[model samples]
Target: MSNTKNTAHGQVQETSSKSSSGTRKPIVLMSMGAQERAGHEYQVMTKKYMRPLVEHAGCVPVLAPTCFGSNDLALYLSMVDGVYLTGAGSNIDPSLYGQENLTPEKTQDQDRDRFDLPLIHAALAMGLPLFGICRGMQELNVALGGDMYQKLYAIPGMREHREDYSASVAQQYADVHTVKMVPDTWFASLMQQAEIPVNSLHGQGIKTLGKGLQALAHAEDGLIEAVHLPECEQFTLGVQWHPEWQAAQNPFSIRMFQAFGDACRQTVEKKSRN
Candidate 1:
């Protein structure tokens, strides 16, 4: 292992040689948000908001671009210590979730799903710490045999989670509703609170949790706001909010990243020893 280096185009990975005891940050492979940029097709990238949070928590950020095949996937799984799945402007294609009622207005990033879904399962199988936000959570659920409500507001009791298009960014992310924490749940134990207010930025949410996973928090309308895989050996927690947007100032958001960073340190250290 040498100093921090670039292994591939648009990819950044840091090794143990340049890191310190408490600073020997583990390389966390973050799944990119895909979309066509300018005239380029399949422009693989991630939001800038997620970087500082992971770095402040003692972890190195690396872009895990859409791995196109099994060999690429295998290479990444062996290189990184943890995974962070970020929110996206696109939605997972309805076909993957056994539903086909995708509204024409709903954006779909098929390229992102192809790699993210497989990465989720692979990381979980190998006991790697994984954290997902918004679309990331939805993909986690679908990857584990779960389904989602395409438009939660359509339900009789479900509150609309979409933000007002005209509101300022601050107003949109402002606490719009409350989510009650389930007692004795994995997230409850870490968050150490009974309830939390989160930003509403998605129309889709987990309608049915995947196998081996349980709801950690729910909205007043009974819509799941967070999920955790209790049976998993490694750390796994997915929230239906954009914590990265204000992770540095938000208490809950900070805790989430810090906890994940600790897990990543342990995972990488163990892997290095082996």
Candidate 2:
């Protein structure tokens, strides 16, 4: 019933013989939990939609709450083979990218920024696979010295990316746009297609790509739909759509997770050998 074999500290304990005692699963730490509820005041925790998708990817998805301090953060980073910065209702504080929250209401996750920004940097520094979706993508760009348009809709020529509130969850997540792949990119290599349709749901988007990152795909209206860190030499990628939604049903979505799973597996093997 589980995809993980056995894991710990970013390593997968794979046994060569039948008598092996234990095997640690390769865990991919998801930095999320319960944010806020109608009657609740404080966001006791954080949560993500990427859990089941990561599990489908063939690794353990561990919830990493919004923790503080360098020491504690280091511990979280060390225990996982990869990081999946899940999308949230909040947006990265504009201040991080040298802008004020043009619309404070649209900017809700400063607390999250404190943990996620550093997490992205640390994961990349260690060369662990890092993937971002929606808000996660914006955080990655900001963390790597890129900027985002506070309100994507406000920007001329940009189409609406938010899901319609009235529709059911399935209808809301319907793929409404086509994202064409940029030639000669890692994402393209995985897809092996000129373009593919993807579901869109976000309030903000990248204005300038972060340092060492490159666009992998763009929407019909010319917005960057996906990006990757070619220089990192690890699996560092992001997409504006919600691939986690019914991921197992789509070839593109399944391929994305499989790639991440492969990266996690590779990390486990490297650690096991060392």
Q: lDDT tens digits, residues 1-274, model 2?
A: 1233645666565533111123455678777634555877454423336554445566777776673433577888778888888887777778889997798756375667888888888898888998888888888999989999888889899999888989998998899989999988778889979999898878788899999889999999999999988778788889999888887688898899888877877787788889
lDDT of 2 at 247: 78
Candidate 2 global lDDT: 0.79
Task: Please name the candidate that would achieve the greatest lDDT relative to the true structure.
Answer: 1
lDDT of 1 at 80: 84
The worst-scoring run of ten residues by lDDT in candidate 1 lies at 14-23
Q: Where is model 1 more than 4 Å wrong at Cα? A: 1-23, 42-48, 67-70
